[model samples]
Target: MTNEPTIRSIIEQELERRGYSLSSFASRSGINRGTLSAILNGNPPKPIAIRQLDLMTEALEQPEGHFYPLYVNECVDSDQPNRRRVKAFLLRCAEVGQTECIQEVLDRIVENLSYIPMIFEIGEELYEKGLREESRLFYNVVIESEKYQHSERLAISHYRLFRLSLGDDAEANLIAATRFELYLYRLPEDYQLDGLLHLANAYLTLQKWVQTEIYSDELRNLAKMVYKNYERAYLQGKAFQFRAERNLVVYYGQGYVLKGIALQFQRRYEEIPEYIAGYADLSWFVGLNESGKEEVEKFKLFAKLNTYNLKVLLGDQSIIPEYIESVKKHPPEILPSLRVIVEASNIHNFFIDDILEQFNIDTGLYDRADNYYRLEVSKDRYLRLFYHLSVYYLRKKEFEEGISKILITLKIAISLKNYNYFMKLIPLFERYRSFATEGQLKEYETLLEGVIKDA
Candidate 1:
C-alpha cells in the first residue's frame, strides 16, 4: 500500500548519505549490533520499543517525535498489534498536533490483510472512550475496506453508526438506517430481532410513521415466535440456554412502547392503555430479577408518565394528580421524560412560573436531557417543547419571544409532516393575536393562514 520508505530503508539511506557504517551508527546510537541487524534485515520485521526509539532518534540527530507517526503505522501494520502501546501512541499523536497522521496511518494499513480487523478494533476502542467522530471514521474505513463485508464487525459497525447518527441529522439518519438494514439483511434469521428494533427506531425519527408501524409489528411478531419456541423447547426437555440472553421481558416491553407511540400518533388513543398495561406487566417481571431492578423501576416511572399523558387526553382527571405526584417524586435527571411532561402540563395549566422553573434546574440536568434527546431523536418532543415555550412566553406577555418560539415549532412541525399538531397551533396563534397590536395581529393571521394553505 503505502509508498513511503520503511524505517530500515530510511536509516540505510541516512547512513549511505553520511558514509557511515552500520556498526559505527549502531555503536553511536548505543543499540546492540545484532539487534539492529535483525531489525534492518529480518524478513519478519522487528519493532523498536518507544524508549530505545527515542534514544536512537536523538543519537541520529532527528528532532523529537519526528518518527512517531511511522511508529504508530508500524504498530497497526504489525501482525500482532500491541493495542496498549498503540493507543498511547495515538494519544501522543493527538497531543502533538499530529492528528492528521492518524488518517495517513489508517489509509496505508486499510488494505493490509491483518489490518482490516485491527482497524475495526481500534474503532471500537475509540467508541468506548466516547470519541464517536473518530470511531465513526475508522468504522467507515472498515466498511470501505470491504474485506470483512458480511462479518459480525460489519453488522456491529453499522448498528453503532446508526445509533451515533441519531437526533443530529435527518440525512445522516437515512444513511444510518440504510446501513443498519444492510447489516440486518446479512445477519442470520435468529439475530434479526434487535436489528428490526433499531430499524423501527430509525424510521420513527424520520417520521415515516407507516414504516415505523410495520417494523414495530415485525419486531413484536418475531419476539412472539422466539418466546413460543423457547416454551416448546422447555416442554420437550431440550437444553435451551438462550433465555438468559434473550430477556423476553425487556424485548416485549420495548416492543409495546414502540407500538404504543405509533398508535398514539395515529390518534388511536384507546389502544394505548392496553399497551401501557403490557409494558407495566413486563416491567414488573423484570423487576423481580435483582440485576434488572433499576431498569424495571425506570420503566415503571416511564409507564406512569405515559399513563399521565394518556389520561389527560382521555379527560380522566381523577387519576391525573396521582400520576403527577408520582412523577414529581423523581427529578428530571433520573427520569428525563418528566421534564417534557412537566413543562407541557405547566403550559396547559397556564402556569408561567412553573414553566420557568424548568430552566432553574441544574444546568447539568438540561445537558443530560439535551444529549438524551439527541440519541432518542424525537421530533415530536422537540416540537412540543417549543410549543410549550411559546405558550410560556405568550402568558408572560413577551410577544416577540412567544412569536419566535411558535415559529420554530411550526417549522419543525412542517418538517415532521405533523399536520395535526400544526392545525392545533393555528387556534393558539389566533388567540395570541388578541395580545398583539393591530399590525402584529394581521401578521400573525397571515402566517397562520399561509401555513394552513400550504398544509
Candidate 2:
C-alpha cells in the first residue's frame, strides 16, 4: 500500500523477469524502440495506448488486458458513453488516493474524449468534497488534453482551477489568471467581466496595486458594455437572466469593495470608510431590497461588519456599543461563519459584562473553526480574530486561555508564511509574558524554539 507499483513499473519488472532486453522486446512488439524507451524512461512515464498495450500483451504471451487489470483494478471497460458510471468510478478511485490508477484509467479512455465533461463534473464534485489535490488532477487532465485546446471547456476548467489555487498559492494563482485571460477572448463579455474580476482579486491578494487598479477599471468598463447590451434587449421587451441595472450597481459597488479590501491590506485605513459605505448602500439596494431579486444579504451584512471592524481598528471605539447591540438584535442576519469574527471584534473593543454570552460565542467559534481554513480569502481577518481573542483573554486575566489563543495565532501566522505577521506577534507574546504562569511561559518558549527550528 505504501508503494503500489505503477503500470510502467510492473511492465518493466515483467520484461526484466522474462530476460528480454528492452530493444528486443520493442522489436518483437512492433513498437518503435525510441517510443518504447521514452515510455519506460520518461520522468513521468507515458501511458501506453490500448492497441500498443494489447500488442505488448500478445508479444509477452500475457493474457489479453493483463497489464490493465494490474494497474486499473477498479476501472471499467473503456466505453465512451457510460459517463455517469465512469464519473462514479473515478471518484471512487480518487477517494482512495489512487492517483496513478486514476491517470492510467483516464489515459485508457482518451480515445473516447466525449467523457471530458464528465471528468470535469467529477472534479467539481471532488472539490466540493474537499479533495482539492485530487480535483486539481482532473482539471489538469482537461487542460493538457489536446482535444480540449480550443474548446469552451478550457475556459471553465481554467476558471475553476484558478478558484482552487486562490489564496492558497500565489504562483498558481498567477498561472491560472494568465490562462483565464488567454482563453477568455473566445468567450462572451460576461465571462470576460468575471475573468477581470478574478484577475483583480488575485492581484489584490498579491499586493500588485497598480495591476489590481487596472483590472478593476477594466471590470467597470466591461460592466458598461454589458449594460448597453441589456438596454438594447430591453428596448425589444426582452429579459435577461440577470438585470443589467442590478449588475451595473454590483459591478460599480464591487469596484469600491475591491479597492477597499486592497487598501485594508496596505494599512491605508483613512480611505476605507467611504468605500465601505458605498459598497454597503449598493449591497443593500441590490441584495436585500431589490425586489427580492438577489440573495446577497450575507454580503451586505459582511460589508456592514467589515466597516465596524475597520472602525475599531482605526480607534473609533465610540461606535462599539451600538455595533454590538445591532449585531445582537439581528443574530440570524449575520453569517454563521462570521459570528466568531464579529464577536471577536466586540471582545477586542467593548468590555462585556455578560460572561455567559461571551462563552457561547467562543464555543460557537471553536465548533466552526474548520470553516475558517476553507475561507482562504478571509485569512487576514481570521488571523486578526485570533489575535484579538488572545488579547481578550489577557485583558480578562485568563492566563491559560490567553497563552493558548496566542499560540494558535502564531501557528496560523506561521502556516501562512507571513513572517512579518509572525515577527509582529513575537513581541506581543513577550508583552503579555508576565501574565502567563511559569509553566505556560516555558511551553510558549518551547513553541517559539520549534518555530525557529522548523522555519
Candidate 3:
C-alpha cells in the first residue's frame, strides 16, 4: 500500500533540504518556533490554521495553494476531523476562488457521509453572505452526497439551489421552481409556506393557470392549517410551535389573491368571488401579533383593490370610473388595474383613452431585460399588460402606437423565453402585419429566429 505524506514529514524533508532550523524557519514564516514545534512534534500534533499552513508552505518555496492537498489531512481523513479548522479552511478556499480546493475537500469528506450536516451549514452561511456561486458548490455537494432522501437538510439544499438558479429566463425559472416544488412538502412548515407560494407564482408567471391553481390551492390549505395552529395556541395562552417567512396573514391573503388571479385568467370569473371574499376582510382572523396586524391591513387594501378589479373584469363598465379613482389612490395598484382596464375595454368596447394616455410614456419605457416597476409586480405581469395594450391600440386603428406596443411585448417575450407569450405575440403581430413598418417587421423576424436557435 502506498502511504500518503503527512504535513509533518513534508516540513521535515523541506527543512533538511533547505538546512533551516526551527528558529530560522519560524523567523522566515513569521510563526513562533514553539507553535511550529507543537504542530510538528506533539504526541498528537496540533492542528495548523490555514493561514499559518499557507505561510509555512510559502517559506518552503512552494507555489500558492500547492499545500492544500497535504492540508486536507489536517482538516479531515482523520478519526476525528477538526471541525473548526475544516470550516475555516473551506471558507478561505471559497474566498480565494479556489473551487478545485473546495471540491477536493468535499470529495474526501463525502466518503465518510457524516460531513453533510456541516457542509449544509457552510452552504447556508455562504448563501447569507451573498457568495451565491460559492454557496452553490456546497449545496450541490449536499444534494449529491446526502444519503437520506427525505431529510430536511436535503430539502433546504434543494431550495437554496433553486433560489440561486433564478435569472432573467422565465422558462429556466419555471424549471427550477418545479424541481424545487417536488421537495417543498419535505421542508418544515415555515419553509413550505414560502416555497409553495413562490411555486404557484412561478406557474402563474409562465401562464400555466392549471398548475398555478394546483399549487395555490396547496398554499391556501397549508396557510389555514398554520393559522389554526396559531389560533389554538392563542386561545390556550401558549406560544405557537412555529413561524413562517412572512406574517401568517400574507400567506393566507396571497393564497386567495393568487388563486383568484389565476382563475380570472382562465375566464372562470364566476368562481373568483369566493376566493376574493377569503381575504376581503381579515378582521375576523384571530390572534394577530403586531406584524400580523400590519399584514391584515395590507390584505384589506388588496381586498378593496381586487373588488374593483373583479367588477371591471366581469364587464361592468359603470365601475371603470370608480376603479380608476381607486387605482389612482394607490400607486402599486396601477399596473394590475391598467391590465384589467385595457383588457375590459377590448371586451366591452369602452374607451379608456385618457387612462392609457396618462401612463403611456412611462409604460412604454419598459426594458426587455429588467423589471420597470419598483414594486411587487413581476416581469410576467408587465409582459401581459404590454401585449393587451397592443391589441387595444390595433383594434382602434392606432397602428403606430399599436405596433410599438407589439414590438415591446415581443422583446420582453423573447428575453423571458416564455413560449406562451411568444404564441400570443406572433399571432397578434401577424394579424396586424400590414400596419407594421419595415423596421418593426424586421425586428419581429429576428426575434423569432433567435427563438428557433434557442430551441
Candidate 4:
C-alpha cells in the first residue's frame, strides 16, 4: 500500500536521501536548527509559513512552488486552517504565478464559506499592489459566494470588477457598466459619488440617454446632500468621513453637466437650461477650497460653452460666433464642439464653412482622439462628429464632400461594428447615390458588401 505524501514526509525523506544533517539542512534552508527540529519532530507538528516552505523547497533542490500541493495539506488537512497561514499561502501563490495552487487553495477555502471576507480583503491588497489578474480571482470568489444580495463587500467587488474590466471596446464596457450600475447605491457614501459619476459617464459615452439622466440625477442629489453635511460638519466643529478622489465640487458639477448633456441629446432643450442653471453659479457654492474653487471655475466655463451650444441646438444661429470663439479658446474642446456645430448647421440650415475651415487642422487629428479625453469616450465623440459632418454636407447639397465624409463615416462605423450608424448612413448614401464619383461609388459598394457579410 502506498502512503500519501505530505510536506513533512517529503522533506524528511528528501533530507535523508541527501545525507544532510538537520543543522546543515537548516543552514541551507536559512531556517534555524531549533525551529526546523520542532517543525519536523513536534508531536502535532509546528505550523510552517509559506516563506519558510519556499526556503525548504529550495534547500530540497526542487522547483519553485514544488511544495505548494503538499502545503495545501498543511493549510487545510490539519485540525482547521489557520487564517494567517492560509491567507499568506494564498497571497504567495498569487505572487509566484501558481494559479493552479491558488485554485486548489481557493477551492478548499470556500468550502466553509466563511473565508469570503478574507478573500475579498486579499483581492483588494493584490489590486492595490498592481497584481490585477491575481486580484480578480478573489474578487470573483467574493462576488459569487457572498450571500447577502446587498452587502457592501459584494457591491465593492462588483465595482472593482467593472473598473478592472473596462477597456477600448465600448460595447464590452457597456456590459460592465450595466452590471455595475445595479450596485451603485450599495457602495459607501464616498464611493457612491464616484460610482454614480462613472455610471453616468459610461451611459453617456454609449449614448444611452435615459440611463445617463438617471445616474446624473442621483449624483447631483447625492453631491448636494453631502455638500450640505460637509458644510454643517465644518461649522459645528464635527468631522465627516465622506471623501472621493476628486474635489467634491467636481462630482457635483459633473452631475449637472452630464444631466444637461443627456437632455440636449434627447432634444429636451427647454429642460436643459434648468439643469444647466443648477451648476452655472457654483461660485456661490459653499465649499471653496483651492481645488474646489478651480473645479467650480471649470463648471462656470462649461456653463458658458453649453449655454452657447444649447442656443445653436435650438436653431438660434445668433449664438454661433460667440460659441465658436468660446470653443476656440478651449483647445481640447474643439472636436466635440465642432460635432455640435455641424449638427446644428444641418438642423438650422445655417452656414459654417469658415467655422469648419478654422478647425480643420484640429479635426484632422481624430486618430489621437484619446489625447483629449478617455479613449473610448473620445473615439465615440469623433465617430459622431464624422456622422454629423456627413449629414451636414449631404443636406447642404455638397454632394462630393458629402459622399467622401459619408464613406469615411461608414468605414469607421463598420470597423467599430456600429450597426446603428451603418444603417443610418446607408440610407443617406442611397438618397445621394446619383451624385457619387466612380471611385467613391466603388468603395461604397465594397463597404456595403462587407457590412452584408458581417451581418
Q: Report, for every candidate in turn, its global Cα lDDT versus the true structure.
A: 0.66, 0.65, 0.82, 0.84
Q: What tens-digit string does per-residue lDDT give for candidate 4 at 1-455? A: 65898789889999999999999998899999999988999987788888889999888888888889888878876446899988998888888888888888888778677888899999998988889988989888898899999999999999889888765556677889989988887999888998898888888877789999999999999998988998898789897786576888888889999999998889989888888888887887664789888778778888988888888888988878888788777766777778888888888788888888876543454555335466666666777898998888877788999899999888877776666677798898999999999999999999889867966
Q: Considering only N, C-alpha and C atoms within 3 Å, which residue pairs clash in candidate 2?
A: none
Model 1 alpha-carbon drift over 4 Å, by segment: 1-46, 50-66, 72-99, 112-114, 128-131, 147-150, 188-194, 224-248, 283-289, 333-382, 388-401, 407-455
Instruction: Please write out the lDDT profile of model 2 over residues 87-189, one tens digit for every residue.
Output: 6557766776767767877787765667678777788789779998898888887887748466766776776677666765445566767667677665556
Per-candidate TM-scores read 0.64, 0.58, 0.82, 0.79
Model 3 poorest 10 in a row by lDDT: 368-377
Residue pairs clashing, model 3: none
By lDDT, the better pick of 2 and 4 is 4
- Lowest summed lDDT across 10 adjacent residues in model 2 is found at 284-293
Scored by TM-score, the top model is: 3
Candidate 4 achieves a global lDDT of: 0.84
TM-score computed on alpha carbons, candidate 2: 0.58
Q: Can you tell me which runs of candidate 4 are displaced by over 4 Å? A: 1-48, 51-79, 92-101, 128-133, 165-170, 315-325, 360-372, 396-401, 414-417, 433-455
Badly placed stretches (over 4 Å) of model 3 are 1-46, 50-80, 94-98, 128-130, 360-377
Candidate 4 clash pair list: none
TM-score of decoy 4? 0.79
